[model samples]
Target: MIIEKCNICPHACGGTRYEDKTEGSLCALPALPKILKSHLSKNIEPGLIGSKGSGQIVFAGTVLNDSECSVFDSESDNKKSRINGKKLAQMFLTLQKQGAANINLINPTAFAHLIMEALREQPLQIPVVYSSHGFDSLETLKQLDGLIDIYVPFYKYHHTQIAQKFAEAPDYPAKAQIALLEMYRQVGGLASNYKKGIEQGLLIRHRVFPDFSRESIAALHWLSHYLPEGTGLSLLTGNPYLAWGEEAKNKQPLKREFERVKTALQDLQMNVGYIQDRETGEFFYLDEI
Candidate 1:
């Protein structure tokens, strides 16, 4: 995984991850800060939870990115400090110490390797889990030798501008996917998919963006053709809505498009997980320590 502080994704904010001992880049975060929370939480949806429980970690500070892209929420949820690899390692160490069987990493990328490395020799090691974004190197699928049971990578918006604004993709939904595929192949393939509780390995996850579910669906269709069968797949609904405010409220039409994505998921026979409502968006984390 490329951990160098970057300005590549949608947030062109050009964050300095290595500087000031930060763990993340523009997200105004570099690594897991003093953990605000960590605990075991269940998925309102069963398949989503492949392990006994998932350990959720929330860091402090609003991350500064390349283009100021905000995927989950906006300025309000902004955190405070930058996290570091070792610090992030410690955070996971805390979860392992507490007996968390799985982990749910949101917008993960910053110090992904560090956290996984920390899991290498723990008691309640992570066998199945989710990433906030897409996988960096599927080779970990091989390197870890399938030690990781489940993986859910995201292919958000297809438009270059959206990728420019929300992610750090220069080409987007194309070359970026190619790179992701190569890594997956290196690890295992569809057979590599696993669930800690039942099934496991490489799960592809995508969410509809404002007026961009079409673009996201295109990426999914491409996966259906390109991805090996039996690979784990999950489609998240509009609970993926961005942090709303003035700019967000004005774009009502985009919400309709997101709704279409939910409808499309309902119409499909794919093995997926859907967030039923905001009430079901329950998360478990070690908030303090």
Candidate 2:
């Protein structure tokens, strides 16, 4: 399946994505979805995985291309990993058979249509996670009503200026809010059991930048009010190496800035998920809410 006129994302680039070539698209990705990496990762939010780990598939390209994204090296990755729907379905089953708690589709917004085709190829017993950079189109998400089980999106920033600066998406905050609301309508808050892990849910992840605690706080406030009660959240410190240059990694201290975000979370009474310790870079689930 190829997107002749791509409108899968909010950008509405209206590109013709052929099976082998992409024309006039901002993402510069082909219609055929490409894989960056696939592995069983336990180092994710606990809500998504169990003892076995989540079957994480990192796809190439993104709707909102942030300069600070470190997920994949676009030039080196996906040279020979272009896969069709059947092949992608097979990969999903393979991971499920390998005892993956869930199939986590990372950065999959641009290829959502193809991914939907892959999902239709087979019946998966485990949950399907749609993880992305919170730039999803409501129309695209509406198409995925029954297909996806979990929505894991990064609520990157609250202000339009910050979003534009980082992702070149001036309308990101508004689009993300609407998309998140639709996601919650589909899946609601997290429902996890000891045996089955997460059944279905909406989990919001936020990365607190060292100098952007105020924006983080405002984003958190929006989440607290808009999302359902007890919606799972995952907080992490922004990577200075990605946001700033390599030299800034040592210079920028995240602990203090992280504390401010934590205070905001506490004040909002939105403490029901994972919080990464900035000092040691360790993630601990917050259960003291």
Against the hidden reference, what TM-scores do the models get?
A: 0.63, 0.93
| TM-score winner | 2
Which prediction has the highest lDDT against the true structure?
2
**Which regions in candidate 2 have their CA more than 4 angstroms from the true location?**
73-78, 192-196, 244-253
| Candidate 1 ranges with C-alpha deviation above 4 Å | 1-36, 43-45, 48-52, 59-99, 121-130, 135-147, 165-168, 186-199, 240-289
Query: Per-residue lDDT of 107-188 in model 2, one digit per residue for the tens?
Result: 8988898888989888799999998889899999999999999899988879999888777889999999999999999988
Error in Å for residue 277 of model 1: 6.5
TM-score of 2: 0.93
Error (Å) of candidate 2 at residue 197 is: 2.6
lDDT of 1 by residue, 48-137 (tens): 453456666643333323222244333233454445555555666776566666555554444445556655644345544545455243
